[model samples]
Target chain A: MDDYRELKPEDLVEDPAFRAWVYHGTGAEAWNEWVNEHPDHAQAADLARNILASVRGELDSFPGSEVKNRVQRILESLDAGRSGTHPADRSANHRDRRLWWQAAAAGLVLAAGLGALIYTRLPEAPAEKKSVAFVRAPGTSDQTHLEIVNDSESPRLVNLPDGSSVLLKRASGIRFPRQFAVAKREVELSGEAFFEVKKNPEHPFFVYAGQMVTRVIGTSFTIRSYQSDATAKIRVKTGKVSVWAAETVLTASQEPSTGIQELVLEPNQQAEFSRSDLKFALLENDRPEVAPIPIEQMSFEFRRTAVSDVFEAIRTAYQVDIRYDAGLLRRCSVTASLGDEPLTEKLNMICEVIGATYREKNGKIYIEAGGCE
Target chain B: MRPKLILQEDPVSPLWQLLCSGDKDAFGQITENCYKPLYHYGTKFTDDRELIKDCLQDLFLDIWEKRAHLSGVANPRPYLFQAFRNNLLRRTRRVSRFSEIGAEDELEFSSFSYEAEWIHRETEAGLEQKLQLVMKQLPKRQREALYLRYYENLTYEEIADVMGLRRQAVANYLQYGIQKLRDYWQQVVISLVLLLAS
Candidate 1:
């Protein structure tokens, strides 16, 4: 107690008793009594407490799935060693078990090779083959089905045949028909992509990624479904999107099982589907603080902004490549307040003001004007 | 803000006893309980996630294999930390093979940017970056001591055991670390005031 009278702020910070009292609410009476007796030391004590609490930071943590996966691998490896081996000589048993497992795997591969050979020789069903060919032909065969893979580090823009567009992230790919069917628009996605579907109520758009299917009538949303990830996520930016497990729609003979749940996500809502558990979880708020969706945060309102700047802003927001004569549009400026409209509508308004006509071809937007007199 | 340390009694001692008596479920519980904190602590040494994960696997496997002889140990948290730190350093040394790795190696601390109510008002504006810079400049041993004491909420004795330092030396490191931060903060406050006056 006497020593506390001579201690500085730094000394108080170093004392475990003081820290335990301040941080964990332990030994509160003793510290309060000391502070009341020596009122002058109160300021120093407060300063010391502030200093101790000031450096607030968070350590990066592993996702729960990843942690569980790692723990499971470790536990399984230990179990693999424990069976049919003396506990005292565990190191020797580990090597022997690995060798045994490898031999069993090799035998299975050999058996599968023979089975494949036998099955390929006995296939004879002309009617089934004809139906399969009809289903395989994408959008009446005149329209080629194309798959575009974004191999570069940046997001690659792919224009859909139905005026919709997709910003495919790195190492992602999307497959679509050259012309969408009149009844429905569909695309297969692997990895991650942000889709801006054109509004066409008669033709609903379907995105098949990982184990989940997201159906959107006309809206912008981001879907992240890497093959290696344990969970696939869909975040809605505008409008509503309904998501369901791929089995529910793809499995026609299953009679639509009641266990599979379909989640309808609104703006700023996200749905996460866990592959391991076969479960879907919905996050209602989906605030930007958790993960920022760029398209949602961008502003379309421009006040006397240069035509070229507006194009650049649009290009960045949609991650699409827009080609125009930069020199021609440099002097042209337009003042327009655009809100909630789709990308094409906003472009139409801007082009109308700037006296230029625009067209989309091969996923890129091109503008034509006579030097914008 | 960090979670308050449960200082009343050792939470893992009962689990450790069950593990010693060959309870597989107890081992799983212990691994789940300690995995996150141990993984966070391992990041201070290196940013190689795979390497840290490998060391973690090896540490737990070694503990499981040697559980029969480890029955005498009472406090499992500090003991686990001490073993984990040693295993990580040894693996890091073998991987790098250029510099001699030691306990004095520079420890990395994640920068502070998240907002909290407890952050003092005097050091609120533009102080997060400055605090990060000051923390980076501190000696590696002092930084490690401060992390174990404040963030992890370990007692001085526990920190000493984990860091392989004497109890008094642990106290000295904490005192020096806090003193450095206080001095740096005061300078920041004075400069801010001068800027406002001008």
Candidate 2:
């Protein structure tokens, strides 16, 4: 309606009422009359409208059911919270009772697994269902846990926020905090689940299956602790791993007493901790074909390469820290054909000829030698 | 993030009134009607679907709890828009453990992807591409204004309220935003010149 004599394409685009007039039939007759009278500016007005119209891409059309379901959940949670009947209430009584119930449930599932492998037909779209299980990490008294269960008849895949993937077997469940624990990445496993962990050295991942705790730097492995089975097992598919048994806790203040012997397992190796004796032992993996590929890909074939470069490559490949006297090892150069051997074998093969002795402590590979000279 | 425009801008006056009077059915209707748009709008600011869902849940809960002290708004779209923007700004900042959430919080704006919107539109084959690139190059504030104006079709005052800017500022942002888009031709010219120089 204002004078359109000096309006640039940009000016026309900026004008809301003008854009409305152009696109939404706002003052269409008056704008048409003005455009007919002033022929030169019509193109700019049209261009401005085109750009404005194109600026609005189709918005995402979400299914209404998702919104309704979400609203219903919030309303239900609010109602429960008002009635002091929230299931995830952090009271001591609630926590202890829930813990007892889960523990009993875990035992029942384990027992049931042995009796009936009821692989019921998986529910349609199993990923969409939210788990009702709320688990809290053992050490952190305050944070709530994000628990996921594979209730379907078949395996269900879960992707964690930290890039870890879990293939949870039917009737299996895992629980970790919504955000990982500050000191460590810890999750509790009740049944069988295969974890493909993206390694973060600072946040060492721990999987507490029943009373046995399996620790790793970064690797793919499966842990099994069905309710009927007295032994919890950890099989390392890649990278270095250590496992130790922790005494089961019945009280709140119980710490995982460290006096139990810790056993380190190499690739293609498995460890089982007997729940009765609370002892862990290393054994060869039942399946050797699958574990060798990761080891082969992480091969160290150094031809006329500096020892430091070799160690650097190895360190980067495995996400393990190799603490050698950089000053001492910098001068040393060695050539070796390292194949798809487990981490320990490769270290031993490289160190045997180089006069270096390697030992692992706290998940780090330490190379000790006099000197290259 | 261009939310799918809910074409149903039907007079929501009755629903708003019913909701303000503590009607749960009206609340459900509002959620069903607005959830997609709100979700799509939230996605513009963050790709965290969980965060988006959480913000929406919090937004509806807060409104429901405080429905007792509310005024009746005829067109509830703008009110809901304002509430969503405020709720998302507060929650996202607090989620990041911000010490204090202030006016600067709304500065966490969503960006537009023009390619997603690119239609054959009978323009030159790659004209849409150039336009998209130029649009993305606009300043975030200007883009916010343009989005509110063009996408949400908000008036200058409504945009001012949602963006927490003055009416004048909103006007300036729209002017500058479009000017920036129009400058894409100049950019194309400069690129041609550079190509010739090379």
Q: Which candidate is the best by DockQ?
A: 2
lDDT of 1 by residue, A1-373 (tens): 3444565767676666666755434554465557557666654575565455443233442445556776787788788874422223324223211111111112122212222222223345232211111111112222245667665667776768876767777656676777775567877776677888888888988886644777889888888876445688888878899887643111111111244577888988888887544478986557642344366566678898988888888888777779999887788897987644567777888889988899988878899876666
- In model 1, the runs with Cα more than 4 Å from the true position are A1-58, A82-237, A240-345, A348-373, B1-10, B98-137, B193-198
Per-prediction DockQ comes to: 0.10, 0.11
TM-score of each candidate structure, all chains considered together: 0.46, 0.37
**Which residue pairs does candidate 1 place in steric collision?**
none
Q: How much is the lDDT of residue B50 in candidate 2? A: 65
Per model, the share of native interface contacts recovered reads 0.23, 0.23
Clashes by residue pair, model 2: A59-B3, A59-B4, A110-A227, A110-A228, A111-A228
Ten consecutive residues with minimal summed lDDT in candidate 1 chain A? A129-138
- In candidate 2 the C-alpha lDDT for residue A353 amounts to 62
- Can you tell me the CAPRI class of model 2? incorrect
